[model samples]
Target: MADKQDKSQTKPTSLQATIAGGFAGLLCIAPLDVVKINMQLQTNRLEGLKWAKRGIVHQTKGIYKEFGARGFWRGNASAQWLYLFYGGSQFFAYDQIKRALAKTDLSSESKHFISGAVAGTFATVTTYPFDILRTRFAAQSKDRVYTSVLDGFQKMAKAEGFRGLYTGLAPSIVSILPQAGLMFVGYEALAPVFKELNLPFGAGDFLAGAVASGAAKTAVFPLDLIRKRLQVQGPARSKLAYGAIPEYKRNMFAAGRAILQNEGPRGLYRGLVIGVLKAAPTASLYFWFNARALEILVQNEIFA
Candidate 1:
């Protein structure tokens, strides 16, 4: 084991490992993502939105009944692209920035937060178009406005200018900056706790990812909801959206105020419950795959 550790320490850490984990996590949680988006976009206080109040099980059944098995994976393609770019860029930047900060006197938490916030901003801005496409694809109903991610991109850009693709970017950055920081902090902190418990191989990584994801997600869920809402705005709102689509017109505060006034604080957290649940396996698989893939790469000296 000592020899193995020394050999592993000598191998280069590959960003590809993080990308692979993101892909795996996306596949595992795609269906839940679809449900979560639908829930987030809905408003129970609005007319014709009473159905939105139904529990997750009912929502899941409704979606399956209407769109069949395919419904649950509406935006999976775009999501795959988003996760690939976001995860790779985020982790790569985080690793680089963290290393640079290691020589500083900043607390570990400060380093993690700064690194994560910067990484999240970089990744979110770079891959944000994919995220918008994913939201539109998932939030739409049977009367699909955008046939596919590429189609959605072309149509949205044509109709609303290229700038339309980045609607909600401000709120996304605001939320994700802290969200990303918290996720790293949670994962770094929780992993050691789980390790101390002497769980099975990779179990610590999995739990750390899950717990970290849940905590961070909860912290920024309202902003996430706002971002999703804004993504589906413009020409498609009247035609293809699922529930009461409030036109915030890029104003996150208006969106928040509207949701608060209309549905109380509960509206802001429309999909929080399901989101947290999904985060469990989603984050677990992501980090586990990351850790395991890094191990394999080191053992094989693949990226060295």
Candidate 2:
């Protein structure tokens, strides 16, 4: 019975399952993500556009009232592509790296951290352009900047050159490395404990993922806000963005310093609650869907 039960579970992580899970998670979190970006990008530099300064419910209602239902999913196309590519590559890399590291004498926490960081680096660099586009689309409330994802790419490349496509790459990488590492460490540590609690179906995975994601995201959220700020700060921001925009032309540190000087420390974490809200459930769904998809695939002898 024990052997049969083991066979019924997913054998490690599968790329297809990871991608499916990420896409599912994205669908669940897109609206909150849009609002989160808007809130993060909001600054005292801007007046008369304090809509995002309110709570999540208020901001959400404002989005709907102003831009209608579709407003909640402004950058969903870019986001979907991001999850598709990043999810597959990151999980595949993590699995391979973890397996390779398994023979080493490193501690389990160290191994998970290293594997997650490396995988996150690879995936983030590969899909970074999509991330910028997603932020751009999400941050744009007053004006229609890029009509579509392809158009956004073309415009970014044409207007700002190659650098535009990777505006906040440094900060993004820094933030993601620790976030990814912590997420894996937290989830791995919490999953067994949650399972031991005799939770309902998917509850263990969901709770483990939620706690992991919430903690990991909150830890590096300031850098995340800085990344989003830098992403939308070029010509488009100067002219078309909803409110006043503070320019951060230098590196991530400079951006952080600027935010600190202008808006204080709380400014660095403007959208923290919304971010936690989005990340927790999104990660919960990701883990649950990944497990379910892997089980289905394995049962069907699909991907092995």
Number of the top-ranking candidate, with lDDT as the measure: 2
User: Can you list the residue pairs that collide in candidate 2?
Assistant: none
In the range 43-119, model 2's lDDT, one tens digit per residue, is 88656646556767778887898899999899899999988788777777888899899999999999999988898
Model 1: which ten-residue window has the lowest total lDDT? 18-27
Q: Write the per-residue lDDT of candidate 1 for residues 1-304, one digit (tens) a residue.
A: 9988797776345454554545553545799989998888887534565445687987888788878999998988999898877777777777778878989999988998898889889889989999999988887778878888889889999998988989999899999999989888888889989989888786998889898989999999999988888888888887655546866757889878887987899889888999889877787787777777767767776655
Please identify model 1 stretches exceeding 4 Å from their true place. Answer: 1-3, 14-28
Q: What TM-score quantifies how close candidate 1 is to the native fold?
A: 0.93
Summing lDDT over every window of 10 consecutive residues in candidate 2, give the lowest-scoring window: 18-27
- Per-prediction TM-score, please? 0.93, 0.93
TM-score of 2: 0.93
